[model samples]
Target: MGMSDKMVTVLRRQFEPTVEMLKNLIEVCPDDFWFDAKHKYWKQIFHATTSMKFWFRQQKDEEFIIPDFGKDVTEDLDKECSDYPTKEEMKNYVEEISSVARKFFDELTDDKLLEPCVLYEEITRTDVILMQIRHVQHHIGYCNNILNSNHLEAAKWL
Candidate 1:
C-alpha cells in the first residue's frame, strides 16, 4: 500500500466514529424538533450530507446538482427547508455520501491529494477533506447544542 492508500485508510477510520455520532444525534432528536424550522435541526444534518456530495465530487457551484433527496434545499441555516427531509432520509443520504467518499479516496493519489482544491485555490485536496470532516463535526456540535439546551442527552462520543 502507498501513502495515498494509507492516508485514505486513516481518513476512512475517522469517518466511522463521526458518522456514529451523527446517526445517534439523528436517533435522539425529538420528532417535534426534527421538523422544527426555528432551529432547522434536521436541516443541519441535511446540509452536512449535501456538502459532502459537493466537496467529494469537486464540482463547481453551477455544476453541483442538489441530490434527489435534497431537491430545492438550499444551505441557508437561517431559512426553513422547502422539502423538510426525515431522519431516515438523512441517514440514507449520509450512508450514500460515505460510500461515494470511499470511491473518491480510492481513486485519489498522493500527488492528486497534494494538488490545489478545485474550489479553494489556497488549499489542497487533502486539506479540503480534513476541513470537511471537521465541518461535519462542527454541525454535530450545532445539533448537540440544541439537544443540550432542551435537556435532551447528546449523542455519546463514539
Candidate 2:
C-alpha cells in the first residue's frame, strides 16, 4: 500500500473500533443513568461526539453546531444546555461522526498527513489524529466506569 493508503488503514483501525465501542456504550447505558440530572451520562456522550466532530472540521477555523435537540455548544460544553438530547439522537450523532471520520481518513494523503495541524506549526495532522483518538478513548473510559459502578454491562475493550 502507498503511504497514504497505509495511514488510512491505520487510522481506520484506531478509530472504527473505538467508535463502535462508543455505540455499544450508548446502547448498553440504561435510560436512568443516561438521563440522570446529576450524573449527566448523556452529556458525556455529547462531549465525545462533539469533540470528534469538531476536531475533524471545526477545531481550527470552522464552527460546530450542536445537534437539533440542543442549542450552541457553549463554553461549558457538556453542561449548561437547557434542552437535552434523547437517546436516539445521541446514537445518530455518534453514527454521523463515524461516517464523517470514514470519509476524512479515506481521503488522507501523505502530504495531508504531514501538513501542520492548525493547532500549531509543530503539530501535524498525524498528531491531531492521535490526539483525537486519545480524547475519545478517555471519554469512553469515563462512561464505562459509570456503567461498571452501576452494576450494568459496559462496552468491553477493543
Candidate 3:
C-alpha cells in the first residue's frame, strides 16, 4: 500500500473500533448511571464525538459550531447544560461522524496529510488526525473503566 493508503488503514483501525466501543458503552450503560454527573455516559460520548467531528474537519475555529453542552473555553467550564441528547439522538450523531471520518480517510492524499495547518498548534493534517484519534481513545478508556466498575464487559479492540 502507498503511504496515504497505509495512513487511511491506520485511521480506520483507530477510529472505527473506538466508536464501536462507545456504541456498546451507551447500549449497556444502566439507566441510573446514564445521567450520573460524575460519569455521565452521554456527556463523555458527546465530548469524544464533538472533538472527533471538529478536528476531523479542516475548518477554522470561527467556522466550527460548538455543541450545546460543549466546553470550549475556561469561562465555559463548569457551566452545566440540561439538554443532553438521548442515546438514540447520539447514535445518529455517531453514525454521522462515522461517515465524515470515513470520507476523510477515503479521500486522503499524501500531500493533504503533509499540508501545514494551524489549530491549537501548528501541525500537519496528519498530526491533527492522530491527535484527534488519541483524544477519542482517552474517552473510550474512561467508558471502559465505567463498564468494568459496573460489572459489564469491557469492549475489545478490533
Measured by TM-score, the strongest candidate is 2
**Arranged by lDDT, best first:** 1, 2, 3
lDDT of each: 0.77, 0.75, 0.69
Cα error, residue 101 of model 3, in Å, equals: 1.5
lDDT of each residue in 1-158, candidate 2, tens digit only: 36546776777788888888888888888888876766667777778788778767624666667665654332244356555677898888899988877766765766688888655789777887888889888888988989888899888888
Off by over 4 Å in 3: 1-4, 69-77, 118-121
lDDT of 1 at 85: 74
For candidate 2, the lDDT comes to 0.75
TM-score, cand. 1 vs. native: 0.82
* TM-score per candidate, chains pooled: 0.82, 0.84, 0.78
- Candidate 1 per-residue lDDT, tens place, 1-158, comes to 36546766777688768767877888999999988778888877877877877877755563766665545555667665566777788788788877867777777776677888777788888887887789889999999999999999887887
Residue 30 deviation, candidate 1, in Å? 1.6
Error of 2 at 23 (Å): 0.9
Per-residue lDDT tens digits for candidate 3, residues 1-158, read 36546766766677677778777767777766766666666677778887777777745653666545242221122556554566676778778877877766776766567876446556887887787778778877888788798887776765
Task: State how far residue 38 of model 2 sits from its true place (Å).
Answer: 1.5
Which parts of model 1 are misplaced by more than 4 Å? Answer: 1-4, 58-63, 68-73, 118-121
Clashing pairs in 1: none
